[model samples]
Target: MSPLRPEELQALLHAAVDDLRPAPDGYERIRAGIDRRRRWRVPAYAAGGAVLAALAALAFFAISPRSHTEVVEPASPVTGQLGSGALAPTASRTASPPVIGPALSPSLSSKGGPTGATATGSATPSTPAPAGSPTVTPTRRAENSSPATVAKDGDIDGDGVVDPDISYNGTALVVTLSHNHQTRAVTLAGVVTPLHYTVTDLDDDGRGEILVEVSGAGGVTTYDVVRLQPDGSLRALSKGPLPLVVGASSSSGAGFSCSGGLVQVRSGTSDDGTTYQVTTTSWRLSGVTFAPVGKATTTSYDTTSSAADPFTARCGTL
Candidate 1:
């Protein structure tokens, strides 16, 4: 027989141990020894495993840059893309380009100096100002240097008959018409009270209206405008009074000269040798009532020949 290997010897010893009885004193001692050894070996093996695991963890941390510490940042809308706030550069970060439509080039300066493009690139053509440059806005000249000239007709009341006493008072033009054995007075007002006026259909309204210059009374000699109503009434339609002026003297003459819608009241002595007192008053007709509007006092002294001229005679109103 050849010499037995270590395996044969170990198998023979295991068979002998297996054949031993459990109640034997030697068996009990051997079992206690095996249990003690197993307890010690288990603790040693567990300690060794713990040390190995610790070493592996240390190696992992050393090898990887971001292994030990984790950094949490705000999540971005795009998947897997880092936000600008997360990886900002040390040098203070700036706002990102706006994600709008196509980017536009910088606008060219409209200053008087040459443009940057002309200096660097080709010269650009410039449009010249047109010859006799058209006026951006044209101004309109005033209608007439003075107010429109109104035509005068003797028939002021539209009756087609001339009345000698009908006239304009600068504020109102009055025409006295005799109809059906009763005298009826008609007056018309105008925007401007002319120095002299003649009756004409100003607005083509068939009815006659008077044009008179409205003037202020005392120190601040300013003129305004007014119109005459068809019923022989005075109406002030402007910011100031009519252009009628009153003389200082007490004895003055007053008379009315009418042409169409235009009427003028002259209250003063003519070229004849006479002194007269003229009291001219204005009133507005409200229904049947005549309301006092304004009053003026004028006196006229005739230094010429003493001939009794009806043209220069004093007149009155009832």
Candidate 2:
């Protein structure tokens, strides 16, 4: 009883109100007030959130850097270790620069000069020249002829000036000589369409003679013996007829033999059978002409025989 329990008093009041009916207008007014307050508070909260979002967006843009469109470059060819991992870089494969130096040729000083060469490698051909050197342009010759080729170079006439000897100029044998400071060239007479020639001393006079193989009128092959004349001209010593030396056999001595101061021609008056009876005739050159020297000799030979041949030897069908 001390303070009459507060709980007892509250229960009494709730019981009294429980039986009483509340006013319907009062409930309706309370509902309307609650609705108005809720509507206003919802709009205020939405507005505050929208402002904060806008401020955040402005701050982010101001602090961030501007974006740029970048360009990419193409990669170069890379060759190196492949299967290990990434590709390895390597040096460029471009060619090296050409070497600049002097080119040596026949008669040409190593300092870049003219040339002379043979296809048989007995001579040297042309090659690329060095810088600042005089260029020697090549010219094409006629199909029927060869270019002026140097066979030997020396004074044949003994006039002092070194002669540039061109043995065969495509069609003929020429000897260019310098006499008394005058230069002269003679294309040997009776010598035509020279194919090639050899320098030899046939007379043993201590002088060289040019033996040329020429094309004859009837397409027959002819040989010419060319000698340097006293008047600085070239003359054919064997203009009459080149020695006939064919059908040569070891069994029979040479059909034609050339010795010091003498030349011989042989023939077999055979009926074109074996065991040819060969006859040899001898002659000597006398002032650019051939003169008979010794008596004619006849000898029998078995063609299968071998002997020391003096010159190109031949007997009819031997």
Q: Which candidate number maximizes TM-score?
A: 2
- Writing each residue's lDDT as its tens digit, candidate 2 over 1-318 gives 488789999999999898888786997899999999999998889999999999999998776654322221222222222122321111101110111112111110011101221111012222333444332212222222321222111223322112223444444465544223233344545443323444433454433345554544432334556666544466766443363333433344234655554666766644444466777777766558777766888876554568543334321001
Stretches of candidate 1 above 4 Å error?
1-152, 167-174, 178-195, 213-318
lDDT of 2: 0.42
**lDDT score, candidate 1, position 172:** 42
As a whole number from 0 to 100, the lDDT of residue 112 in candidate 1 is 18
lDDT of every predicted structure (CA atoms): 0.32, 0.42
Please give the lDDT score at residue 306 for candidate 2: 81
- Clashes per candidate, residues 3 or more apart or on different chains: 32, 5
Candidate 1 lDDT over residue span 1-318, tens digit each: 899999999999999898766665887899999999998998999999999999999998676543112222221121111112221221111111111111111111111111111101111112233343221211111212112222112222332222223334544444343111123333344423333322233232232233333343432222222233454343443321133332323333333333223223445543333554443444332322334455554543343547432222121100
TM-score, each model?
0.19, 0.39
